[model samples]
Target chain A: MYELIKNLGTWLTSGSSWTGTDGIAHRLAEHLQYSLLATLVAAAIGLPIGLLIGHTGKGAFIAINLASFGRALPTVGLVVLVFLAGGLSMLPVYVALVALAVPAIVTNTYAGMTAVDPDVKDAARGQGMRGHQVLFQVELPLALPLIMTGLRLALIQVVATATIAAYVSFGGLGRYVFDGLAQRDLVQVLGGAVLVAVIAVTLDLALSGLQRFLFRHRTA
Target chain B: MTIDWSWIGDHTDDLTTLTVSHLQAALSAVFFGVLISLPLAVVAHRIRPLRGFLLGVSNILFTIPSIAIFVLLLPISGLTRTTTVIGLTVYTLVVLLRNTVEGLDSVPAKTKEAAKAMGTRPLRTLLTVEFPLALPVIMAGVRIATVMSISLVSVATYIGDGGLGQLFTDGFQRDFPTPVIAGVVLTILLAVVADAALVALQYVLTPWKRRRA
Candidate 1:
């Protein structure tokens, strides 16, 4: 155990590990790039659909089923299937990650929007607010917490699966784990896994903090 | 992409074996997750200060990615089925504990007081009165955890222990889409089936809820 820790410490602190194409810096950048792109795309697709169904209260069955179906699809299968079908390109990774993320965003956004008090919405409407105005000014603000929750969940899942992109010969922090396994280097594997965990936890904390901040007024 | 029906027909036995193992791993993890979480949730419910701390820990555990958690356990548990099961159980604990705690909280205080007035012991009250009332919420948690475990077991393939996930790695190495499609379809099928079963179980267990609905 002691030796494992020492080796991991050395691997993490080694100057070579922080520089060059294979460095942690480069890998982290790739991880964030894939995660960000997939999330933005998922948000673009999910947000409008979620808001639409949530505001109009129609097509909920389809949206709910879509969420559950997306949840059931394994990340690895999606990536490999897309990779094989789409050829050897990063597009497959983005596609898989985006697919993985959309359901959470859509579900949470819809839930958030629908959770808004009907009376509150009615009050806004009674004050001569238009449909879009009520949705935008009232529903959106109240639903921001759940929407952010969905975004947070999607981003975290994307970051995690972004490592799988490395499995398909793309660039990301997952390269370390796969490369380490191939070479039987426990330090690299552990170091890489630790880094991924750290990033995930940091992101979770930041987002949760933001969620709290956004809803500070709501004791519930 | 076109699916090879003949390929699936030829691999029925292999698919069945993999599916069985996949379900075994996911179900066992969920079983253990509920077993462990129920006690912790009960204790957390009783101890007000401990509730936040326990929930926070589980939240952190949930935040750790599936692949990362599996790999993190590799050195300690090795690349075995045990490692996969343990990693999955950890993931389930997050949801199970939270939901269990929330379920316990949702129990009506008036019900507990009425039980006390009827001379029920605290333990008896908890087991009889509180638990039955909390079943719906707790069952919801179980359903989510079960589906999550089924999907997450695929990540165990990286550690050499995925059940149906093996089909995915097989297809990838062979550059064939048949097994991959099979794995995806079977996994989703298994998850949906499990979720449906839980919903049924909840319905049967909460007849009062059904009547009210």
Candidate 2:
């Protein structure tokens, strides 16, 4: 165990591993690229639909069912299927990641919007706020915390799934893991796992902090 | 990229075996998950100060990806099925513990008081009254955990024990789409079936809910 830890420490701190084309820096960038692009596209698609159904209180059945269906999807299956169908490119990674992410965003957004007090909406309307105005100013603000929660959940899940991108010959922190496994290099594998865990925990903490801030701002 | 229908046709036995393996992994994880989570949730519900800390630990555990968890356990569990089950069970803890506690909290104070008035022991009241009333919420958690476990088991392929996820890795390596498609379809089907079965179980277990409806 001591020797293994020493090897891991050496692998993680090695200057060569920190630089060059195949380095941790480049791989981490690629991983974030996949995660962020997919999340942005998902937010573009999911947010509008979620807000629409949530604001109008229609098609909620479809939204909820869609979210559940997304949850049941196997990320590995989807990623590999898309890779096979779409050919080896970044597209499949994005497609699979986006598909995985949209559900949490949609469901949470809808839940947040709907959970806004009916009395608050009534007051906004009575104040002569237009429908769109009320939705934008009153509903959206109140829904920020839940919406952030959804985004946080989506981002975390995407980061995890994005690790599988390396299996398809893409670049990311997962490259270390898959490559380490292939070579039976436990040190590299442990290092990769630690990095991924760090990213996930850091992201969760940052988002949770933001969520708490939003919640506090609202109450104040 | 097209699926080879003929390949699927020749693989029925293999498919069935893989499906069974998949279900066994997922189900056992959920079983042990419930065993561990139920006690934690009970304590969390009964003691107000401990709830946040317990849930927070599970939340952090849940953030770690399934692949990472499996790999992290490799040194200790040596890439065995034990690693898969343990990792998956840890993943289920967040949902199960949170939902069970919420379910227990949903039981009305008045009902618990009435049970206590009848000289019922705390444990007995919990088993007979609170647990029964909490069944619906707890079952919802079970459904979510079942689906989650089913999907996550596919990622266990990298660890050499993903069950149906084997088909995915095979097809990916062979650059064939048939097994991958089959794996995807079957996984989704298994999750849906498991969820539906749980729904039915909840209905049967909560007869009072049915009577009211």
Candidate 2: Cα lDDT at B177: 88
Error of 2 at A48 (Å): 0.6
The alpha-carbon RMSD values of the candidates against the true structure, listed in the order shown, are 1.2, 1.3
Off by over 4 Å in 2: none
The sequence of per-residue lDDT tens digits that candidate 2 reaches over residues A64-152 is 88887898888888888888888879888888899999999999999999999999999999999999999999999989888989999
Q: Judged by lDDT against the true structure, how good is candidate 2?
A: 0.92
Query: Top DockQ: which candidate number?
Result: 2
Fraction of native contacts, model 2: 0.83
Runs in model 1 lying further than 4 Å from the true structure: none
For candidate 1, the clash count comes to: 0
lDDT of 2 by residue, B1-213 (tens): 677788888999999999999999999999999999998999999999999999999999999988999999998998788999999999999999999999999999999999999999999999999989988889889889999999889889999999899999999998888999999999999999999999989888888888778
Tell me how each candidate scores on DockQ against the true complex: 0.82, 0.84
Error of 1 at A24 (Å): 0.5
